[model samples]
Target: MNDRSRDVRSIRLPRWGRVAADQGVVPWLVFDEEGKAVEPVRRFLIDFVARDNRVGSVRSYAFDLLRWWRWLRVVEVEWNRATSAEVRDFVLWLSGAVKPRSAPRTVSAATAGTINSITKKPYLDDRYKPRTIRHSNAVLRSFYDFWIELGGGPLVNPVPLARSDHRRPHAHHNPLEPYRAEGRLRYNPKVPRRRPRQMPDERWNELFAALRSNRDRAILALAVSNGARASELLGVRGVDLDWGDQLVRVVRKGTLAEQWLPASPEAFVWIRLYQEEGPPLDPTAPLWWTLRRRDHGAGLAYQPMNYEALRAVFRRANLLLGTNWSMHDLRHTAALRMARDEGLSLRDVQTILGHAHLSTTADIYLVEEESQVIRRVQDHLAELKKRAQLPPPPVALGYQASDLEVLFGGDQA
Candidate 1:
């Protein structure tokens, strides 16, 4: 058997298991319940993604691949031999353009497809959004490229990738002329950019006020003040904090680079309290502990907090405050406060965020506040009037009766 085939056979996949590296990068990949890896493609992920990407990211890719696999089975196309048309159909299926084939044997009023779990068939739905389609496209493209690079699949990749900002590829010769997609597989639609969801000061205070526990309060405060993503906050360990310097070391997602950022005084206070009141700390234990208790041979043991637990804490606060804000909103709020309100430079914000590229920081988190943007425009207009040599108007003005009448409507004026 080939290396790819061998790799697939060697994997012992569990319903909920993470592939971790010996030391670095906590979760390389996680296998989900929805997807099962078969021969070549399963092997492809083992070598390509599982050992390289984060656990959460691997889980996403697994789901993406699962969709592709199910589509292949439904359409009766072999993975290596799939044509560009078939790939397009898959994309369309994911975009909710076309529904997947369902079993006539089963009946459900909600006409969407439901799969026979025993048979591993998809009872498909046209519920996919653009982002879902784009992500699936990327995963397949990556998988196919890895396969071809290993000198396995067809010489030419079936999935054609197209230009994003502009249509068509930058290549001189386009072999896919008749197919008309060039060498590209995806035609990404322009997603309209919107301002980041930032928690207003009043709303933030209210959300915090609604929380009764110090643990939840600290968790939210740390996530916001540190500009930490959900994963980063959960992954922090007790040793990661430097009490003397008031810095907490975090593993930046995707890159796994270690960065030490300042913690908020309020966060520090609460963290200290939580650590003190929390279960007896092992030096190597995770900083955050879940309230979940299990029998630990002799006594009850509290497990380290994870992504789902952290989310549950936020969910309760959200329900209490009657707000729909998310964890990332706190990160955005922090970025907004730092760059717009606190007058921190873009570079400073970028460092605090631990973004590999300053452009990503500038593009997403550095969005100017609406009120700030209005003030800027007003200030610019006033500056332009001054520069044009317009005299400043007197503070006190005598307005004519006609002026008042025109300003308001006649009788009201």
Candidate 2:
């Protein structure tokens, strides 16, 4: 038999799974513990790519399907035989189980789920967040939907919608009203809403002092001033900068539309310094380049800065400051400052932040700080105490105290 046919015959559903990305036409594929490609999963992923979904999305779905396949192996259920019970059990397992650590732990387990003092954010532990479980449910539901339509897998979708009645989902829902939770997928975990944590000015200064180079400084300045996403900032090219206008052009995420955003004068100054110190730049070259070089076949050459490189810069600063700050934190800091400190309107902030909807910007940046609320509450309590300690007011100027008391009652108190 041919190699392709021979490989297919040797494939079997394994207890543990692996996700692999091919350098060929296929973006991603799943394999069993025995290193045999799961034909069903391969086909599904290929179809997903053909539908114009992102390659990153394909990778995410492949991992989710791999997890589902592993769970199926444990229960000795074939893919087509999986029921709602299997999906429910999978979510339950994810809820309680600690995620496997890819490397040795550096932080103590006691610190898990606690608020970090420096960053003012929660310390993440080795467990799947509720959002991840919900996403997995969605991936599984979509996967089964694709198969059922082709008449290859189970007749009905195993991952069913969370329905309140037998009626169709969203059958009579009002367009203006918020979507009800009953319309969501069954077995999906409820993800709690987390407010974005902005860095305090003092902590921001400390982080700035820890940066190793002017390139990182310029990056931080631009990010904190423009509220651009990390990826969008990294995508900037040398030609995209306008020194006269003090603006930088970035391609917006999701929309891919180019937008020119205003940046601080200090950011442009730092950019000039960084560019002066670094290698000579071509107008078409990437604005941000790595300091170090790696051999790319011919010889050692500097590469354009990517998300990972930008993250590493912050990682080093975080290490020095004893904080866990991400690149996105700068965007939060900028948005909060614009909305709260600078007295900018929500619409203005939304435009700068590149949010598709005004409500998104308002919901994230318009939240009252807990500390500010506590201070106001304390002041109110103090005022109430002062009023309570004051003596009774004197009788009206026109009437005697005894006469007023007799008119109302012996004791008006």
Positional deviation of 249 in candidate 2, in angstroms?
A: 2.0
Candidate 2 CA-lDDT value: 0.83
Where does candidate 1 have its weakest 10-residue lDDT segment? Answer: 1-10
Give the runs in model 2 whose Cα sits over 4 Å from its true position. Answer: 1-15, 108-110, 168-182, 296-298, 341-343, 381-413
> Candidate 1 lDDT, tens digit per residue, 1-413?
01121222222222242232323233233333444325464567567554676556765776667656656665566778766666665655454443333444343334346543322224335566666777777787778878888888766666676646644344465576553334434555445576775676787888889776777888888988978888888778889888888888888886898889888888989988887788887767778887667775968878888788877776687556545556887898888777775667888988988887889888986666665678899999999988767553433357665666677655322
| TM-score of model 1 (CA atoms) | 0.70
Candidate 2 C-alpha lDDT tens digits along 5-124? 112223333447788888856688898767888988888887888887777788999999998887787667799988877777677778776666657676546677788786778878
Residue 394 error for model 1, in Å? Answer: 16
**What local distance difference test score does each model get?**
0.67, 0.83
How much is the lDDT of residue 333 in candidate 2?
Answer: 87
- Give the CA lDDT, 0 to 100, for residue 274 in model 1: 84
Let me know the TM-score candidate 2 reaches against the reference structure. 0.83
